[model samples]
Target: MRGLIAAAVGALIAGNIAAAAADNSFAVRDVRVFDGDKTIPLATVVVEDGRIAVVRRDAPIPAGLMVIDGHGKTLLPGLIDSHVHVFPGAEADALRFGVTTELDMFDISRDFKTWKAQRTSLGRTGQADTWAAGLGVTVKGGAPLEMLPPGMSVPTLDSAADAQKFVDARVAEGSDYIKLFIETLSEYHDRRTMPTLSRAEVCAVVAAAHADHRLAIVHTQAEWAAREAIECGADAIAHMIPDRVVGTHFIALAKRHHIFFETTDDVWAGASGMDFAQKLARDPRVAPYLSPMQRATLLATEKKVTPRFFPTVLANTRALHAAGVPLLAGTDSPNPATAHGVALHEELQILVRAGFTPQEALHAATALPDAIFHLGRRGRVAKGYRADLLLVDGDPTTNIAATLSINRIWMNGYPVDRTLPKK
Candidate 1:
């Protein structure tokens, strides 16, 4: 099934190669614009030479340019997924659902250059842009060891010197950022045990990354681990603390340090229910955009409800968000019932359910991630930004689920072909 989807995506890419190479320009007039930060009730946005040219009220339509009448539609900056695991066709699946950028937390292969190039390559069609942390730093026989590919090397760090060396190697490999693993298996499983990096080691890695001018993000599912990561000067927390509700002290500390958080609520929710996946696959608005592999994976199995930690996760996220700590929307994609691209929409809904206003949810998925990651020239509908945008039938700023009603998606001024071939 994966092969079939890959082949179909390849054929679509080949068919669009000529269109992708040509210079693209257009204007979306009379649209309700969500300019990353707020909603502009009525506006016109123009794109030319693959960049936003003008964004204003009642702009004059230029002669000889293609125009899309966006009456009653809302225009938003393309969604950005802050946490994902990239694989073949992942970007294609993401683009189909209006996710134009995906920030990968870890990839066992450590092939950063290839993925980075694919992201920045202009005039490419049918793929979402990507930024990656090549390989995550973990301890010997750590949490991720069980998940690593059969023969992949599992490097361990103990001393501060070892931490520095590990970070240096990742920097040399062109990692966009550094990812540190600090998970304790006991937090998630009853009997399993795993080693974690010491606080000194984590601090050392953070210092090394900062010396190289890179942000270090940490993965932790427990409160103690999260507190340790923050004390160690990690810039972001990749997953929310799931074991219990975080207190005001930790929230204050995170705010003081300006640490961003990715509340991967979809991951935790999916862990207990194949229902989440099935619901997404069955949604009329999202089903049309999913690829064969995605559809098959979502419908493949039904698992009994297990103990869920997401209620506490949501509470912690609300606390951090209310305290002015930055939040990022991310779905730990391709994990269990979570699918790439589509999972992000579910995440936005989850955020709204967790006490975020719909606009706040949109901000978490758009402007916030771009600002936090320093991803330039994207994630906003403004003059001089990259022309990555999504047009939906209703106002998503008020009703978050409207995000899935994608009317059109533009990447670098080119309209993406959203049609899927019949089986």
Candidate 2:
């Protein structure tokens, strides 16, 4: 009986895969284009063979191309979340809110290779494209181990050799980038401490990643750890500092090093109140795109009562941006009050509230991540690029909230099914 059930499930999965690869050509006409840098008032975008073939004003529509009327709509590159710990069902939920790409900070799944292949294949649809750091490098009793299952061995680096070995193993496993956990855990649990990677070890790991031509990103919460990560040659900081306000000197260092920061203020804000999550949960515009599981997660109560850190996070983000340090918008989804996909929209609002112009906030989620991570042919609406695009009803360049008014989403030129299934 179990074998029969397994076979049936496998067949259903295969059928869905086949259906996702069916459509790969279309044209969206008469839409305002946000080409990752500036806005074009009126333009036509044509997609053929899963690539954007033409983007111009008054272009002649070739015969046999499915034309989608984009009058009174805004076409932008699909959103990208730079920091997320993905599991099953996350990608589909991400796509529902027009997030066509998710940059996973850490993933431990054994089937990661399979998922990566599926995301890269031409004509793929339904789920967001994923790039991940297969397994984060951390100390034995450090962060993430507390959240992971018992007896699961995580690489603990105490020396430079260990760091090199760990990075090499991750590279062999096809990790897109290297993720380092530099958390101290003192703030999360009072009077308790966790082991952290030494500076030498971190430097070694970063050097190894650079030697392999991969970016090294670090997860840190305190200003001190963030400074250390930067000093150790980390290409990016995965989370904002929440313990205290960041100083201009630190911002200058980040700017000098060309280090990008991912603002995860939503995760911190969710703990103090449900405002962010509740707003999305109550939003009628996004209601149909959210799955049952995503809706429930968004509405769930906060489990941990950590000190309010969003204020500090927001202030630091503002300071960093003012100092010319590049910022990337990310919501640490499925963490507590934050859900997948929709939380990114909230993050953009937070950025706007924290002194970023709406256009800058939009670029943080799109072009910045692509440029920093070297994700070629994405995060832009241009000819010779993948047809990963989002069509919204309003001008998001001026009003960040307009991103939520999602009308259509295309991944590799294939339209997404926005309707939720009936229970």
Instruction: Identify the leading candidate in terms of lDDT.
Output: 1
Off by over 4 Å in 1: 1-23, 189-191, 296-305, 421-423
The positional error of residue 16 in candidate 2, measured at the CA in angstroms, is 21
Query: How far off is residue 105 in model 2, in Å?
Result: 0.8
Please, what are the lDDT tens digits per residue for candidate 1 over residues 1-423? 999999999999887765543547888999999999999999999888888999999988788677889999999999999999888888888999999999999887666777677656557478898899978888878866777878777566767888778888888988899998887765665776678888898999999999989999999988888899999889999998788788878888898888988888887776655367778898998887788877765565435445457678778878888888888999888777778889899899989988999999998988888888888778899998888899999999999999999999988778888876466
Which ranges in model 2 have alpha carbons more than 4 Å from their true place?
Answer: 1-22, 304-307, 421-423
Residue 238 of candidate 1: its Cα lDDT?
Answer: 92
Q: CA lDDT of each candidate?
A: 0.85, 0.84
Relative to the true structure, candidate 2 reaches a TM of 0.91
TM-score of each: 0.91, 0.91
